[model samples]
Target: MAVNTSGRTTAVDRAYSALLAEIQTGALPAGAVLAEVEQSARLGISRTPLREALVRLAAEGFVVQQSPRVTVVAGIDEKDIRSLFELRRGLEELAVRAAAERGDAAVFTALAESFSAAATANPGLADPAAHAGYYALISAYDAAVGDAIRNDYLASALRTVHTHLVRVRQLAKDNPERLVVSAGEHALIAGAIAEGDAALAAHATHVHLHNALISILSSIAGSSQTSTEGTP
Candidate 1:
């Protein structure tokens, strides 16, 4: 959690991003205690900025204050997954539809081509570098869609959703098959938007989300079963 003072971002922003990355990558697992004094020292920032970062994470539901002073990373369960996807489906559908209607066709077409390439690459989930590259493509696609929408309120809401989504994503990171399938799904959505087929884009987004939720839930169940079997 070493701070980079030379960077343009504020200390609070740096601390938040560092802590958030740790939480998402499971370096700080759910229920991991975050002692203010210790964390502030570890992040190489003062308590005031650290508290600001914690407050932001708490507001996003990534961490919860257990008492006046204690905070811990929040847990994710099947219910949380389902609830997340439910909100995601609605918001993403709206975003895709708006993008289809308002976005530059060439931009989405380029994204579709990129997604197709990612699918062909078929990077194994175990390779962190390759997987990160694939995720970067997805992030680019998301940014394109977000930019096209031009709705500040909707964009803000989606940002919050994505914050928690980063953590949930780890549950299915081992499933390369899902990654391939998701690539295809994103391609379809991007293609539909490129063609200005709002209805098709929305429908494709819905289908993609449904599949994603299933994959994540299945991965969670499998992991839980494995843990249970090993416990005895």
Candidate 2:
């Protein structure tokens, strides 16, 4: 229900960001109804702007329009995860390879060091503050890679995939061990890019993504089992 009163962004943009954040954080969980009038009133925005935001989310696959008036957050399952990663692996590998060929070595070297530190720190999964810092480091790494590639088209495509990825990441909230391993893998990828070794960077990216997909799927399965067992 936080409404943006700042004139910096359009009403539609503000509504979209607020709703997207809620969806990503699982506040507006999968299958949650996004009634136009209700959300518009809650967000203190007009129905027109809210509909604009919903249309944008629908295009990004974050929401589905069941009818002209009914919209809901999209559901993500194991199959959706696999499909997302399949696209991610291809795009990210290409991005890193290009970055290796064109990026500033110093930038990637610095990212490599940061990722190494994250691996060593081994932040606890239950600690929200620690996990936020860890995710910030990953975001920095992502920005570095995106800047290195210098391709708006590729970056735009990757951004779309990452939008869905934010929701998927919630499934791995309890897997601190996986985060530690992922940090190491990122360091390897950054190190390879810093050395301007295109082939190595691409290969490292592939391996990292392969391991990440496995870990994520395993985490999702474990969470599902736990929830089922706890159900009366």
Best by TM-score: 2
- Which digits, one per residue and each the tens of the lDDT, describe model 1 over residues 198-230? 999999999988988887777777675222100
Please, what are the lDDT tens digits per residue for candidate 2 over residues 83-164? Answer: 9999999999999999999999999999999888877863443344566777888888888888999999999898998878
Alpha-carbon runs more than 4 Å astray in model 2: 1-7, 122-129, 225-232
Q: Where does candidate 1 stray beyond 4 Å?
A: 1-7, 121-129, 225-232
| Full-model lDDT for every candidate | 0.82, 0.83
Instruction: Tell me the lDDT of model 1 at 161.
Output: 87
In candidate 2, position 12 carries an lDDT of 88
The collision pairs in model 2 are: none
In the order shown, what is each candidate's alpha-carbon RMSD?
Answer: 5.0, 4.8
- Candidate 1's C-alpha lDDT? 0.82
**Per-candidate TM vs. native?**
0.87, 0.88
